[model samples]
Target: MAPTSTAEPRPSTTAYRQARDTLVALTGQHDRAVAEFRWPEVGERFSWAIDWFDQIARGNATTALWIVEEDGSELKLSFDELATRSDQVAVWLSGLGVAKGDRVLLMLGNQVELWETMLGVFKLGAVIMPTTAALGPADLRDRVERGGARVVVANAADSAKFDEVPGDYLRVCVGEADGWHAYADAYAEQPHPFETVTASTDPLLLYFTSGTTSKPKLVEHTQVSYPVGHLSTMYWIGARPGDVHLAISSPGWAKHAWSCFFAPWIAEATIFVYNYTRFDAGRLLDQIRRAGVTTFCAPPTVWRMLIQADLSGGKGDLRELLAAGEPLNPEVITQVQHAWDLTIRDGYGQTETTLQIGNIAGEPLKPGSMGRPMPGVPVALLDPLTGELADEGEIVLDLSRHPVNLMTGYLGDEERQAEAMAGGYYHTGDVAQRDSDGYITYIGRTDDVFKASDYKVSPFELESVLIEHPAVAEAAVVPAPDPTRLAVPKAYIALAPGWEPDAETAKAILAHARGHLAPYLRVRRIEFFELPKTISGKIRRVELRDREQRAFDGGQSLSQEFRDDQFPDLKA
Candidate 1:
């Protein structure tokens, strides 16, 4: 028997597929792809779930999603099965008063129910607010208040976090919980017809930025912005049909939607997940080998941890490797290339947009460079002071081209939006430099770049060098108050296993930095400390900077902080 869609195929679906296949055909031809690729002109009405996912899922028996748990329990859903299942879920949610354009706060782990609910919400035309379960009651309250959430779907175990959250929103839980509707009840009924009617510019997703520097901003995405914009991301990953793609990301953030949801599905590839309570590199490798994963994307932190583990066994069935979330250090790339016989391609993007730049597969890569602008992404580096194009400055997207991948704007914050989209460009707070060959190398964030004795300093440049040392596992560099130089680079080091955080380790790390870095970029002082991070695992350098400022103002010296003068050998 042939499976059928709940609704008929729309023209928008064919347009999107044609655009996607065009880019796929030019997979290895980076130059031609960039020059010829154009954004699909999706007309007014477009619903990716009903138009694209459903049309492809009809009568398709291929596995679309694969999830493996730590306890060895697994779940696999075929394309046809997922389409029918999501249709039933949409009907059930509609029965529960979930209406079009209503805001639904979805907080779930990397489970099958999460995917089902997301697709169902998309079909129902409801705006999804992806909140991390790690959020506490305080943060939840703020989201509810500011986001104007009308419904909330959460795990039963996390329901307590919302007990203090005052909202009139309907509560639905995956497991049994008092005062909450059972999510399992959605499966009790057969599928029903649910039409998806939404404009291409209709709001589909609302993501809160990980508040690394300040309060989290509400980023709004249209129906096509993510579902269609991720074509570039799919191209960067080189995902092909039937390929099992695994991306290490949580459900709450945009990266999750970037890899686990849109990009893989857009390519008609299997979205594979290996959920573990704790990160175990060996077990992850086992799953990758067992499932025969072809494409993989992970953050720089995970890559660093994986290198520490045994990689004597070669990479299994892996064709593409990628790292993002931050600029990857060159040494880590070298180590992985030596062991796995594969180079981890580096890419760059932000929560507000899809992949803007990346090392395309099958193209020659420049070491430490994040490749040229992605096809259809209007990338340009503009001078921060002059607001004109520069070889090295803040990275901005040319708004004149009407890039479809960018978010509509910051929701309800016109002043910030005006500033962000000022000068006919979208300012990405980070800065970068482009070589004559057009390969872009990431500098530090605009706020993170400082100066010492009138010479500019980039924290990432120093931290990259510090991590190359044997004793240093992770390092965060900030400006320390100095008497003569006004300010100097001070490093907070986290020692690796079998290394002690003593004076000897600090001196070794300092000397290594001096030898590798230029004189102006030398590490002046070091302290053994744990780095602070946001919930998303990004280093909270703002806190570190504040700590340094306070310590300098108090005229106090840390007992463990080592200065270059303390080690006469470093004085050279």
Candidate 2:
């Protein structure tokens, strides 16, 4: 006889659906949306993976995940498919001794198993420690030790890296690997409904910040902080139900959760992905055209590369174009606008918080501005020296409101936590200037901004001008020490295709900077070198600053560097 089976009653999502529908209805109505929206008051025993994802996924046939591989292969998973699969994985993992509060280290690429594990872990109320696949043994060891991870999920190719990482954690490999549990075995298990064991404030994720200046800090987020807080990101990206949103970010980064998972999922939209081993802007555009991606988000690096390709191929039904990871230069935005007739909105946020400010849809965009403070996010610019509110200073969030988007301090670092949460505010450590209309224009980081001839010089401001030159592809500006002025603006440039690293190319870039910038902010020194970047592709300006300091101390000039003074005719 066949095994007897009974259907389980669908989980109630009355409150969750009410809140989600409110935001979905208010799309493109910025003022009304901000004024009427309120963070849902979920009581104890709230698990987004179960309460939200699975509830909405019931009998839903809409594609939730679409992954296109480099070799023209693809994988599509509907909401119901993922829901059932994750349920099976959750039961399988639970049998493997994984339980509530366990820390599971997830280090996988953009694969179906990554999503399944994320959902399964959440179903078990386990804490997720997301690490990039690009990490080596040293980074992995630090994550395991600092994060207190008890289980590790990685691809078969990365299993060998764990040999050097000493831990008693359960090793679960996505594909076949010796002595590791096969992820394929989970699919054979009987699917079961996931029971919720999480509270609203329970720890859900631990992220190691992409260390650009110092060592990476462990950023902790609760079940609500990210899953609920990304409502602002949904608003910023203009996500809507039935829309396809493609956010060009690698897994393990906060932005991935921001758009690739929570934001789009909350909006009941399709999460589209193009998994490429190597970035080909033309190929990416072709996929976008083919997929009918409605909303798109990418870092400045990817946007710059896209403009180099022929953008005329297919617009891909793209309605909203957004840029983050760093401030979007006006020149790049202009190039895209000229090609697509759509403005690329800029947004500002960090690993420490959700979307604090952004150029939302249905708003007039200032070319270089990052738009206004997101609704429900109270922002103030405090003078770095005075610690008083100012129009142009360090950006901070008012702690009085206790915004749900902010992280719950850095884990295991009370000193840093206190410093960041001091003065009744959460200091962002970045500087910006607000106009009378309240739009914020990003300056360099608080540490990146330097003084030259008693005038403050923003490297971003200078680098923006440098990239406007035809010969330059990417540029990093740092203050080079000088005896007379203490420090001067020096540009390290990576040339565009067909441009050489010769003196002529440097001269042309310097001339362009001199023409576009003020006399005090001119690019005095030029060097043709590759900019150092973090594994997540963020430019590490701190590394370049250290190099500048060392060069100044040695009093020996690098042979590769070119100075504006070296070419007399190029100077203003």
Candidate 3:
């Protein structure tokens, strides 16, 4: 279907369309795409939800969204239906005094209303602060106070969390609830066409990033930063028109918007979602098969769990598979390829930017590498000391070109923003090594890397090797204090099913790590415990490091910890 000729706002629709078409044409050609792709120079009055989405949505009958519940209930909406429904929602919200640039705290799950509210908020030019439903009253209070939210939209079950949260913000509920505006009332309103009240540079999203070491930082993204910048992500995921893209991510994180919203919509693809209360790999795979998912993107955690389940049941219509949010272990990738004959590609990006690096489809597979710099993303490995380009160093974005994908800055924190955008480069705070082929292999976070016996040790590398053990399910490597060496590599592991935290299991895991890693990178200590993580499911290595430091300082010992030095018979 072709887009209708609607009078576009300030940005000439021609420029945006041409740039988008160029990317679509260069889907499989990685090198050319990287060289020729450019961020479109949008005019000052551009609005993506108004100019782009509504344009493509006119007269389009293709399925735009498909959501399946745990109980087998489903909700499907076509492009035209969503466009019209979002228009009504925008009108209803406008009537409730929502104006352009007003901050709205949106906290909801994977329901149809969430998507509708997002689009409506976008259409109204309101800044959306996407919050996870998992947060408690304390977190909500922090968000409302710091974000200056004028309105809050959440599910009925979560509405009571705001009882003690002092705010004058409008309380809008998804389901029926007292003292809250019902969201379903918008559906009964007459359909109204959306008009633009935003510029291309206006703030569209205020994301509270899940901080690993400190308090969560508020990352701000402009109108063009995410919606238009996700072309790189769309290309990386190989989201072609009519393809059903399924990305398993929570509602609050940037990854959700990366795949579930912008990337899929940019490709004119169907956003497929399966909502489950628990982690059931079998049921997820069954839903994928039933939905005929073609392009799939999931975090490494989900991919790891999926591999543990039966993959012998044949690959569903899944053509492209991707893993992000964290570094994917080579063992997990190898196991999936062996079962389905399809490689699980890896990609790298952050909440502060769109897809910076990714393994594009049809590209040569490099084990343990997160492929090359994404098209139009000026990526460089800068030496932390000299700020010179290096083969292995901190991953930085060359701001000389000022990539459109990057966030505006850390909101209300000018000092941190200046630090992050210093030296004419946007420091990612992560480290990597770029090989001759330009494939960037992840090292570890800058703070997570530690020195042991005068040798630099990357926790991710050790954790990757440790997870290869049969008894290990998930593992985190942190520095454990030592009498001789400053620190030694210690692994905190979560055992797989049927594996006990006994001496026998610990001995086998230690032996496996000894066989796999180099002498200097050997696991000197092992502990059986549940790994701590943020709400977004990322392992909190800083917490482990702190615990180890306190234990060493107080001359205290942790329970269930085994030391390689304790078993002198085992050779490193």
On lDDT, the candidate that comes out on top is 1
lDDT of 3 by residue, 387-420 (tens): 7999999999989988899999998888889989
lDDT string for model 2 (1-572, tens) is 11111234233356656666776677667678778887777667789998888877867878999999999999999888999999999999999999999999999888899889999999999999888898999999999999999999999999999999998899999998998999999999999877788988899999999989989989999988898788788888888888899999998998888888898988888999999878999889989989999999999999988988898775769999999899999999999889999999999999888899999888888988999888778889999899899999999999998888899889999988999999999999999999999899999788999999999999998888888888888999999999999899989888899999998888888888888899999989988889999888888998988999998899878899998888877754
Better of 1 and 3 by lDDT: 1
Point out the higher-scoring one by lDDT: 2 or 3: 3
Q: Report the alpha-carbon TM-score of model 1 versus the true structure.
A: 0.98
- Report the lDDT tens digits of candidate 1 across residue range 1-572: 22334445577877887888888899889999989998987788888888888888877888899999999999999888888888888888899999889999999999988888998999999999999999999999999988999999999999999899998999999999999999999998689645668888899999999988999999999998899899999999999887899999998999999999999999899999999999999999989999999999999999989989888877999999999998898889989999988989999999999999999989889988999999999999999998889999999999999888999999889998999999999999999999998999998899899999889999999999988887878889999877888899999988888998888888888889998999999999999999999889898899989999998899988888998889886643
Local distance difference test, each candidate: 0.91, 0.88, 0.90
Rank order (by lDDT, best first): 1, 3, 2
**How does candidate 2 score on lDDT?**
0.88
Model 1 spans > 4 angstroms off: 1-9
Q: Model 3, which residues run further than 4 Å from truth?
A: 1-12
The alpha-carbon lDDT assigned to residue 137 of candidate 3 equals 95
lDDT of 1 at 420: 95
Global Cα lDDT for candidate 1: 0.91
